[model samples]
Target chain A: MEAETFTLILDLMGTFAFALNGGLTAVRAARVDLVGVITLGMITAMGGGILRDMMLNVQPATFQDWRYLAVAAAGAFIAFAFSWVLHRMAIPIEILDAIGLSVFAVAGAIKAMNFGFGPVQSMILGTVTAVGGGTIRDVLILRVPSVLSEGLYAIPAFVGAALTVAALELELNGVAAAILGASVCWLIRVVGVYFKLNAPRPPRVEPGNLQG
Target chain B: MEAETFTLILDLMGTFAFALNGGLTAVRAARVDLVGVITLGMITAMGGGILRDMMLNVQPATFQDWRYLAVAAAGAFIAFAFSWVLHRMAIPIEILDAIGLSVFAVAGAIKAMNFGFGPVQSMILGTVTAVGGGTIRDVLILRVPSVLSEGLYAIPAFVGAALTVAALELELNGVAAAILGASVCWLIRVVGVYFKLNAPRPPRVEPGNLQG
Candidate 1:
């Protein structure tokens, strides 16, 4: 397949996975209706890309392509319809979430490079693309965003984005490079989840001296 | 002043107000450091406009102009330094927030109309522009967005946006029209706050039947 075609496929897959994950999370976390479920799902699936495109001053791919919306809605609907069953399969959903994060990170980095962003900016944008939707979802559900507090979420995405940027710099920009970057991200995230690891927290502060 | 110049001033004033409000909220709500305080403040000031520009497929004005960043940072720094005093002056800060909301709503509507959106789309976008930043800030601070739950937040914005759209439709598209729209929104919000009013809530649902 052409690189564009491959990227599109990966994007769609990530969209579906994120939508499903977001919908399931809403079901577990909040007392929302179908509209809320679908809205949250679509936001989770498409919010990151929209944010990325906005920063890049380009039209959002989610708006330009109907397939992205369709897939996201379908995934959300499936989760809503089968929440009872899906809620029990937490491990699988988490793995799918990891997949979404990895693909989005790689795709975001590549797109940033295509838009002439430097390596550091590309890497940061890539991580933002990967975590933005989940952060929004967490916020809507009235929770602290996992990226700010959880272990390995943004770290894996950042690492993946950096690896993708390295591949492009080394003139190894292809399906193989994408896979390599994404696989490393996925591996790190899965391990982090399995180990229940945590990123470091700030040292304790005095009660009334919270000033930075 | 020319309408464009008037609008620019209103936009900057709104940015400053939101940054200060965001910074104050961070100090009160989260045990964050200086970086967190400033990040949240900037996000609250600029996130809405960036989202609006993204949806409109235009370059974000925040990125195009240096003044926006400078003003936002200054406001955040002020809030950080004066949190002890400002936290006690809640009513004044709230009034500033209302000003930000009103101006943003009117400006967003005007900008959307200039971009050739229809009345309904313009109105919605305008409300989004007003509430979007606050929602993002609330999410980062791990609270339900006031727009989703509080009285008269989004409603006032929606009303202002609608009035702005109406003024545009009547070819009253200038500083006067902007002021008229913003004033009505500000009045309603202030009244709502004074009365401790609430928008209608969903009817009570049975426990365990929260499916939408």
Candidate 2:
């Protein structure tokens, strides 16, 4: 397959996975109706890309392309319709979430590179693209974003973005490199999830010990 | 002053107000360090404009201009240094927040008009620019956004934006018109805060009454 085609496929898959994950989270977290479920799902699926495009000073691909919207809505609807069954399969849902994270990280980095951003900026944008939607969803539901608090989520995305940037720098801008970067990210995230690992926290301070 | 200069002044004032508000909220709500406080403050100050610029397919003015960064940082620093004093001045802080909301709403609509967007789209963008930063701040601190759940926040912004658009459409785009729109929004918001007013909610449903 052409590189563009491959990337598009990955993007769509990520969109579907993120939408499903977001929808499931909304159903579990809030006393929301159908509108809320689908809205959250679409936001989760499209937010990162929109954020990235904004930084790039470009139109959001999500708004420009119909497929993204359709796929995201479909995934959210499926999650809403089968929340009872999906809620019980937490592990599978997590795996799908990891896939979305990895794909977005890789795709975001590549797009940044195409847009002529520096390696560091590209890597950061990639991670933002990967985690932005979930953060928004968590905020809507009044929870601290897992990316900021306790999770190996951002680290894996960062690593994936970094690897993708490095590959591009080394003139390895092939589909193979993209797959390798995403797969590595997926592996780290899955392992972290299985082991229930977390990034280090600040040393414990007594409540109200530090005034603003 | 030229309309351009006036808009810039309003934008800066709004940025400062939002930064202070965000920093104060962080100090009161979370046990975060200096970095956290400043980060949240900057995000709250700039998120709305960045979101608006993204929709308009333009570079964010916050990143382009050094003044915005300096003003926002200064406001956040002030809040951090004077948290104890500022915390006691609740009404003042709320008034400043309303000022920020009003300024952002009017300026955002005017910019959209300058960019040749339709009145409806401009109105929506203006409201988004007013509320986007606060919404992002609420999410970061893990609270339900006041815009979605309670408060007459979005309504006042929408009204201000509508008025701004109407003025522009009527070829009355002057400093007076801008002030009129923003003042109305600020007045409405301040009154709402004083009265503890809220938008109407959906009818109560039994717990778990509606499936996703």
Tens digit of per-residue lDDT, candidate 2, span A28-52: 9999899999999999999898888
lDDT string, candidate 2, B1-212, tens digits: 87788778878888999999988887777755555566578789988988899888887767666688889989887877778778778998888889899999988998898899999999999999999988888879877787999989999999999998898789894677778889999999999999999998788986787764
Estimate, for each residue in A69-157, the C-alpha lDDT of model 1 and write its tens digit: 99999999998999999988989889988999999999998888888777877886798799889888888888777676556788889
List the DockQ of the predictions in order: 0.18, 0.18
Clashing residue pairs in candidate 1, if any? A33-B212, A34-B212
Q: Candidate 2, after superposition: displacement of residue B2 in Å?
A: 20
Runs with alpha carbons beyond 4 Å of true place in candidate 1: A1-51, A54-110, A116-124, A136-142, A150-212, B1-3, B30-39, B54-60, B69-85, B139-142, B200-212
Could you list the chain B TM-scores for each candidate? 0.93, 0.92
lDDT of 1 by residue, B166-201 (tens): 987998847777898899999999999989999998
Could you tell me the TM-score of candidate 2?
0.62
Q: Which has the greatest TM-score? A: 2
- Candidate RMSDs in Å, in order, are 7.6, 7.5
